[model samples]
Target: MARPTTLLACCKLYISESRNDAALRAIEQAARGGGGGAVVVNRFTDDAYNRVGYTLVAPLTPSPAPPPLRHAVLGMVRAALEAIDFGAHAGTHPRLGAVDHICFHPLAHASLRHVADLAGAVAADIGDELQVPTFLYGAAHREGRTLASIRRQLGYFKPNSSGDQWRGAPETDALPVAPDAGPERPPRSKGVVVVGATSWVDNYNVPVHTGDVEAARRIARAVSERGGGLPSVQAMGLAHGGGVVEVACNLLDPARVGAEQVQGMVERLAAGEGLSVGKGYFTDFSQDKIVDLYFRSAANTEG
Candidate 1:
């Protein structure tokens, strides 16, 4: 969130207790480390009862003239958030939001209600603070709630005030999807954001260690739209904590796509390069507590 100059606005953020302290510490630590724009601390609606961060950065680019078409036509929501970045050339993860959509993962919280309340409260604050009208969504609150199921809600609301709860409609290469707010920002020439909450989507990543970075990148690229791969899957190649070139993907449905599939795909991609995935690793997928599949898996693993 500290990445400055390009962050026009922020929402749906994950600033944990440690993050807040680090941000506060960075205030004093800046001079000790380097300098400038290193700390930020703000009061949330109910300080004692909420855990959520909503940060939006304005893109620094030629606005809609650049790559808004890709998002508009391809239905790649993250690009809408990128449109507002004001500088996609220097941006973080791909996103789709004037305020990005947020799904709360219950880790520290005692109940889903706890996080939902925090999310709704945070959204309310953003609406009030930014003067950007918004609707809080989830099981707790009921204002402007979407009635459709997952299949129906995917494109329930457009970036320009169009409600397309049903799919298979002609995609809008560059249409204005009005914000949930009444007076939406005049389509930054690109598009807009659809922010809310939903069931936990799987966050799965795969790492390759064939020493062929470009080859891994190609596989990642193929897995993502930039190359054309899975449906409802956002993918990319990165060199990070993983010891090797990794093909990271956000699998929308763990049932259809899991660690096994990702491992399989990477192995197949590595064939031409004569390399293989170092290890099968999976993490950061949230499933409802009511669904005991993972809980049982955890038990079996322990057994």
Candidate 2:
């Protein structure tokens, strides 16, 4: 049968271990199963955060059986859950689980509903098979809940230890809200996972010259939409080692607000505090770029 042209799905997973290249390789290997042409668009590791992010893209064609893209993502999640032990995990990044966060984005002709369906499927598998607590966000949830709100309710932004480390295990056995899947009590080793489907978002970070995380936090709040700054933007301040702090931001609508605007805002905020802002960075490529790359790769493989 000829391959059907279809929408693209991008699965971005944030695993707890950044220093272990072997674990990353294991996840990648699992994602490449069944001869699926799932492309790894980006793989980033932050030692200070002790987290790794892998962005995988694949064509999502209708099938009688489970789709290859979905299978690939679940395989990777299983691999990550097995490799990472959140009980001993510690990092600057705030997380609620070993898998931490997994977000599915629609690219090309894909609809939000399409990705949301996939998110729901993954959540079910993670809950039923893996027995991990799973929360749904964005379009996946009927309430149109945001990831930030869920994280906030779960105390995800707070660190269990000084210098942003969550050690030994999550503090609470009971969640503020019952998870969409799995047991209500968080697992000791794996904790819980947040799965969502949302429109394309850009993860951008702006570095500041100062070492004061509190000042960075102030700047982050000042420039966030919640703080009455930019619209469709979520910002957080974090220490990135080396006497430097960063304003990590998620630009929900790049067309409405993008990395440039975020950089400008951070610069303006830093200047008022006698701090200098460094050039910002985008952790992943745009959705269009990722779709283009996937097709080019598919074409090459066909050739």
Q: Which lDDT tens digits does candidate 2 get at residues 1-303?
A: 133457788989888889877888888888777466677777888998898888988877776767667788788889988887788888888988989999999887788999999999989989988899899999999898999999999988887898545665776687889999988888788889999999998999999998899999999998899999999999999988899999999999989998999999899999999999899999888777877777777787788
- Deviation from native of the Cα of residue 285 in model 1, angstroms: 5.6
- Per-residue CA lDDT of model 1 for 160-213, tens digit only, reads 212211112224433243334423442332223233444445656676775454
TM-score of each model, paired residue for residue: 0.42, 0.95
- In order of listing, the candidates' clash counts read 31, 0
Regions of candidate 2 where Cα sits further than 4 Å from its true position: 1-5
Which residue window of length 10 is worst by lDDT in model 2?
1-10
Instruction: Give the top-scoring candidate (TM-score).
Output: 2
Query: Candidate 1 overall Cα lDDT vs. reference?
Result: 0.39
Model 1 poorest ten-residue lDDT run: 159-168
